[model samples]
Target: MSTIDTSKPHSARMYDYFLGGKDNYPVDVAAAEQVTSLFPAVSQMARTNRAFMHRASRLLAERGVRQFLDIGTGIPTEPNLHQIVQATAPDARVVYADNDPIVLRHAEALLHSAPEGKTAYVQADVREPGRILAVARETLDFTQPIALSLVALLHLVGDEDEPVRIVRELVESLAPGSYLTLSHATGDFDPETWERVVEVYRKGGTAAQVRSREEFSGFFTGLELVDPGVVLAARWHPDLGARQGGEEIPLYVGVGHKS
Candidate 1:
């Protein structure tokens, strides 16, 4: 088992805290509370991002895509990607990846797949696309359509990390008809207030790089976007119930096909 450090506040744990889950440490709660004081919609954004994931996974599974690779998968909240897809297609396959040991500790909960479907978890970082792809393929078929999920991830990947290039490498490994469901943190809404929240995270040793709409859309460079392309998180296909409980969230969401 990977060691869990409770002294430093990790983003995954902070996110779990935002969602009212009990898996976070006191440090995480303190950092999350700081962000909440600056931006009360923090929790709303987290919930909305997760709802969008459910909608995106269900949509792809309904479209007959049975493989999924979800990276930066935070602490397992219910109705995880596999659960959503397997609910529609009993034999779907999902590979969940995360760099956080906190999440690795909870990986088994994320692995409870349908009797016919299969689920696997890899403890890895998003920056190393090759390692993730290599390990994930053990449970997923790279020759088939796979939805690469980067939900509420990427912003933590600062400029030095070459976030766009990392995404390109991962997408390049996919076969045609593969999908990319992504949601990123944005400063488009209440920039000043959002800056305060970002500052709080930075103080906690997490570097956050909120993106602009164009920058967010740039991640889908060579793909075809689905309907209502790249809009506010709450605006992305709400018919699947991605509504934000009546609050405006700054995250931008989109799903693209590698055709």
Candidate 2:
């Protein structure tokens, strides 16, 4: 296992800590507390994101997508993507990518796959789409439809990084009929709360780019958005699975088909 640096708070660890998980350090807890102070709904937002991922993954698996590429996969939490996908399609193959070494150390927990399914983890930053795609290709056949999920991830990639171009590159590499499911944080809900939370993350060594609703939708350009396009994460296909209600947490979620 890699040695975890408790000195600096990592996003994944902070997220895990917010969700009341034990996979984080004191620094992470401190960061979470700071963010929560700014936006009291922080924990609820994290749980909502997790619930969205579960429903989206299940919906994709039911739609016959047996392969998944999940980027910015945070600390291993119960009922991770693989569990959701494999439960629906036993043969599902999933590759989880995260920049945090702590997640890589806990990758073993994520590696536990159903006998008929497979799970692998790669330690890579989201900006390196080439490396991510190359490693994902080993488990996911590019020729087949793959559900590329970037839930609660893009906001972490700021403007200087050209998030649109990064997403386009990854989407272009997939075959037709592939899908992109994502949920991103937005400032459209409450600018005051958003800015404060952004400052907290920025101080933690990562810049948070809380995008506008239109900016979030822009990521789906050149693709057909699934029905009820770009609604709140909780509102996307609620009937697909579990629904955890929280009125204050704001997130935009949508799924698109690569035509």
Candidate 3:
């Protein structure tokens, strides 16, 4: 059994709390509530970000990409990465990687793949791209084009880690025709409220950093941007059902394909 340290707030559990799931602890709730109080849109951003993942996965599946590598996968929310992709391409193969032990505890739900498809989970961090790629090969074939998903993740990686290098390293490992899709918390549009909201995570013992628009877009360098490039989460393929709201979502999402 995986040990969960409930005394401190974890990013996965805090996200589950925001999504109105029962998998969160009190500490996570308190931390999430603190952030919500600072920026009411925090919860809404969570939902919007989730919706973007679904849309992005489906888009990749539609492109005949059957393999996926989802890093920083949070607690099993309804319509998880596998469920979404399997619905589109029942033969799709997926590998979920996360550093959280609690997420590993609940990974059984993620493993429920279609008989025609497959799923695997790796207890690894995104910073160790090589480790994740090696372990994920148990389910996904690295020779084929894969949709590498970093949804709602990178911000947790502090500047000292040189986040751009981390991302580029991962991108370099994938085969061409592979897709990279991601969503990031940014302070570009509304710096005041967004910065305050980030402080809540820092106060809760989580080191988080929100990126600027230019910085966020840099993650997709050297890749072909999908149509309607680098837009707000709600604007990414809205025909696939985006959140309904007039306010700007704090997260920016984009999908790009390697040539």
Report clashes for each candidate as comma-separated counts: 0, 0, 0
lDDT of 2 at 25: 84
lDDT of 2 by residue, 65-92 (tens): 9999999999999898999989889899
lDDT of 1 by residue, 149-225 (tens): 99888888788889999999999999999999999988886788877877887777777789899999999999999
Taking all chains together, each candidate's TM-score versus the true structure is 0.97, 0.97, 0.96
The lDDT of each candidate is 0.89, 0.89, 0.88
Residue 95 error, candidate 2, Å: 0.5
Q: Pick the winner on lDDT between candidates 1 and 3.
A: 1
Best by lDDT: 2
After TM-score superposition, the amount by which residue 90's alpha carbon in candidate 3 deviates from its true location, in angstroms, is 1.0
List runs of model 3 lying over 4 Å from the truth. 242-247
lDDT, residue 103, model 1 = 92
- lDDT at 76, model 1: 93
